[model samples]
Target: MARALQACLDGEVDEVTAQRVAVHGEGCRRCGVEITVYREIKNSLARQEVPDEAAMARLRAFGADLLTTGPAEAGDEAARLGGT
Candidate 1:
């Protein structure tokens, strides 16, 4: 599940993989929460107005942390931070 989410984020997962994940999300509460978190994270990032190096560095640092921890842990951290 985490793999699928990461793949989706990286644009590596095909439409079919995404669709399968969507279907699983429809039936599983946990997966649904993950998907919701994913969407909220996406939207929050899209809404950010970071127009400087500091902001970009922060984003890069976060990305590095996310990479070390993987998707589920990153999502959990985001949830803790009121991200999703």
Candidate 2:
């Protein structure tokens, strides 16, 4: 039940799995509450605004640049931060 819960909620599980989860949820109070809470969370997140794509792209580029920095440059950066 635990393993199939997420897939069932995502509608990625097969019919048999869906049935199993539904049946289990019916009998298990905790599973029913978990399903309800997850559905609420998913719905709440869906209603939130999407981020700015251009800003997101720039952030990704900044992260990529940090990753590609050489060891010498990282040491230089550390020295700039007053670290030996």
Candidate 3:
């Protein structure tokens, strides 16, 4: 059921499978809630904006810096970048 829900949300299931999931969700309260939550999360993610080129460039530079730095320096850099 969880697999079906995830497949439906991800649009990976075919029409027949999707119809079956929809019908099952209609009859099962738990499935209905699961579908609603998945749909909301999917829609929310879909509405997110992509980062700009400058932001991507900065991330690439940070990654390169981390790769070149020693472990201790990497930890400090990660802390400076607000990463754990």
Candidate 4:
């Protein structure tokens, strides 16, 4: 499950895989802890600052694109919520 979660963070797994992980994590305490750790680590990485204003603007634009186009999983309605 940890490997599967890593695959999710690496974009190697599809949304279906992540959803499976989520379900398992909900029932299993160990997997739930691991998923929480994964999310915290990912969030920490995302908090790192870019070197310049231009780079920040580019990130903002990229996020806007996601907002407009939606998430990676097509036809998955829950995936559309909260800009996941």
What is the C-alpha local distance difference test score of each model? 0.81, 0.84, 0.87, 0.77
Error of 2 at 35 (Å): 0.7
Candidate with the greatest lDDT versus the true structure: 3
Q: Write one digit per residue (lDDT tens) for candidate 3, span 1-84.
A: 798799887989999999999999999999999999999888877765553668779999999887877698968889999997
lDDT: which is higher, 2 or 4?
Answer: 2
Ranking by lDDT: 3, 2, 1, 4
lDDT of model 2 at position 77: 91
lDDT of 2 by residue, 16-77 (tens): 98888988888999998888888899887776556467778999998888888857789999
Candidate 3 minimal-lDDT segment of 10 residues: 44-53
lDDT, model 2: 0.84
Candidate 2 residue pairs in backbone clash: none
- Order of quality (TM-score): 3, 4, 2, 1
* Number of the candidate with higher lDDT, 1 or 3: 3
How do the residues 28-77 of candidate 1 rate in per-residue lDDT, one tens digit apiece?
Answer: 99988888897888877877745567888999998898798888896888
Clashing pairs in 1: none
Residue 64 error, candidate 1, Å = 39
lDDT of 4 by residue, 1-84 (tens): 578878876678888987888898889999888888988888767766544668789999988887877755444666566446
